[model samples]
Target: MEHNLLQAFTTRKHTVLTSSKIDPTGATSTGSLKVKDNISTQGSQEKLGKSGEEEKNLKSNKKLEMRAKDTGSFNIKMNPLNKDSLDKPDENGREEKSTESSKKMQTKKSETGEGHDNSSFEAHQETQGAKGHHGNQTTTAKIQQTTAFISKQDNKRQANQTQIGRSGSNVMLDVRRRDCSKTKCQYVIWQCHHQCMGWGDRLRGIISVYAFAILTGREYRISHTFPCNLKEFFHGNKTLWDEKVITAEHATKRNIKLFGFLPTFGSWVLQSSNLSETFPEDIITFRTNNDIIPYLRFNKNFTKTIEKAFSMPIDDFHYVTLFRRLFHELFSPNKQFEEKFQKYYQLLKPSNDSTLVCAQIRLQFIKVSGMKNVFKFLQETIKRVGKSKLLVSTDAENVRSAAKTLFPEQLVDIEGPLGHVDKPGSGCRDMEKALTDFLMLSKCDILIHSPSGFGQQAAMLKYPYKDVYQINYAGVITNLTIPIFKLENLYEELGPLGGEQPPSLPSRYIKNPQKYFT
Candidate 1:
């Protein structure tokens, strides 16, 4: 019996989980079942022994007649197949002893349900409870026990251990990382819808953008960086330039003077300064027009600048040159000019300087040697009403020659020393020179003028005119009221008297028969 029991202990087909392999403190191992801590396993066995005794007594006390008693404890019985048990027969004398033993075996197998020793299960539970109560094991030992328990139920397992000591405690990290939202940065261009008089309108938009850039220190690359649609800038048809369109920065940077276009330059750049402070009136453009003059009047800056530029009596030629230089500075869009105006315009105020300019238009009479010009009539009209206002028109050369001839005593024949006299529609530099020459004279409240475009410019000055006059050969003096006039009638009447009448030379004049009849 001892040998059989020893053999059963060794070859019971059980699994062993030794503490030496699991927990360093050592644990109990009977079959595959591992029970940690020897004390708990011993206690569990003691409890099981008590339960067995109690179960035996309960079975003995049961009444044996008709019904089977249901005792929770599993029933045990001896094997009936053994020769020792077969030797006994029941009182019925028919092998009842063997039959009873077989019945007990069947009952034990059925009652136990699981074909395992219950004592081992009770021992394992007690061991786990003790380990949980103590809580003194390393994480590795705990993990091993837990894994073993889970492996008993599930076959599949995986491990992913990581050392997380490097990264700071304050930083939170995800095991799996991803990118942020996807969006693109872009820009758009806006445009306008109508027909403006000329490039004046187009340039106005350019100037506006340019001014904004300069004021805010923003950069505007006219061609490559800021390729604008012309239609956006103007009200007419859309245009795609085959070549690069000219830009204000080009002329400003190159320091080039654009003639016939000064009015545009004046309107765009100088106009703003007129409202702010007295800046140099220097301007150059490739074109000029009445539209430019209206712009000056309408713009607060140009009006202010012009008012300040000519506010004081400009007497000396040096002063005039200084004024011209100052004027030019106002018109230049270079960074230097921008900074200067931003500083000066802010300081200038209407109350600080209230000086007004006095304008006069002097139109010379006609000469038979010179041909008729309609520009003179326009000049005479402006002279009539704009004597007090700043006049920008000029006289015809014939009318100017006539003035030199007739008013030789009052006005000197200052011949051809004028620069920029070749500008188209300049009216022979009469307006530019007149503004400089008589800017300080303070004489001639009214312009005593004949018909000429030059006179029209002088009439353009800001003024109230009952003070201007338009003189004709008939000595019929018209008031200085109208801003424009017609000289065609005057020229017809002043022409040679009639047909067949020899042209008589006026006093102090010689017929240029050699230049013509010769």
Candidate 2:
């Protein structure tokens, strides 16, 4: 009986070991059979004491085999069936492998100079997470790096689009056309009816009318037929302003009320209750040589309107900012004028490191020629600025000849007969030269000019107002503190013109502004 019980216990122990090795789900049943076999074997050993030692040794061997099989089964159940899992080592080895894989991917990405797609990267991250904790961390870092690269690329594309838009590319032109098509646009036509004014004067009137048009929400147009069509030299920057939009019926007296001078007109508009109500005409034409910016600055209503239209604060509203915006928006050189400007500008060879000084000598408007003093100032300025180029723009041929002869090394000017745009018999070629000089003068580092509106307007084009000196009638050089757009400065310099005094709000209007507006 003892022999039979021992043999049966051995057979049951072998079965439990085989089942546990083959299937992890048999662990519970294998454990129960082991317990039962141990009880039976111990009983058989005690009943047959002669083979007790052998039985004890066999039981010990069985416990070792069962433990080994159980551990193997648990491992097979816990681990996933994947190549990475099958080859994985201990915790330290997995961490090292994760680090190595991350470095390899980064190096490959850098070598190829390419970014991973977002969807593919996300899938990689999920696979890495399933592999190990260290791999998940590495994937997180890669995601941040790739995301930043994508963001940078997006920003670059946006910047390029913005630059294209500002250059008046076809995209922006189409957008403007769409906007105009959506509404019945109103216009303020600035007509030059044989006005005895120079280019500077006409520009001032045009910009003034443009400002009014902005306040009244109307498009600004130009009709200058005295010397030549304005389009012969200049065209619009973002828009076209010519007679094509106007017809014979639209040019009647009713739509052509003229505002003779800017100061008086500005005063009348400011004091009036409402501009639209007072001037009911659809197309009000202005023909003046003076700017209404200084007058507009004083009117609270006008300032508010301007600020809103430009999306700027009133404090930021100044001569330089305002004039630059208007000039660039309204005027662009035509093909002929642009070619001439480029030729002269190239002759100057303006450099970023080296300074280029512009001297505008207008003998037509100023009473005294301060030629000697002007030369002296130029010499001092050149010496101060070290390596420099000097560009001279003037209406007189003798002045140009003198400058070229005196400063041959530094002097640069267009070779042509100078002529005023407003004067009759000034051919289109000469007028184009004048326009080219005006634009080139604005592109200088320093400016030395005479007390002429042409010089003043040219100087206004330079942003942040560079070192500018004005030579008076007595040939005395003075540094202009404020731009010519300032009311006090303009009034002091130009004095009362067009038989109109400096703009002043009426006392009644000043006391009760609401009463006048209402």
Highest lDDT: which candidate?
2
lDDT of 2: 0.45
Q: Give the Cα lDDT of each candidate.
A: 0.23, 0.45
Quote the lDDT for 425 in model 2: 69
lDDT of 1 at 361: 28
Q: Which stretches of candidate 2 lie over 4 Å from their true place?
A: 1-183, 246-264, 314-321, 364-369, 383-386, 485-518
lDDT of 2 by residue, 104-209 (tens): 2211111111222211011011010011111111000000001111001010112121111122212111113323455455666677656335676567668766
What is the Cα-based lDDT of residue 336 in candidate 2?
71
Query: Candidate 1, after superposition: displacement of residue 236 in Å?
Result: 34
Clashes of each: 61, 0
* Candidate 1 lDDT over residue span 1-518, tens digit each: 32231121121233332223422111223111222211211111111011222234234333320011121111111222321111122244321223223222211121212222211111000000001111221111001111122011111111110110111112121111111123221111112221112221223233333322222222222221112233222121111111222323222111112211222132233224322122111111111111122223233433333334333211111111121222222122334323432332222111222111222222223221111111222223333332222221222342343333322322333233232232233342322243333222111233444333334323322122223443332222333322332211111121222122111111111122111101
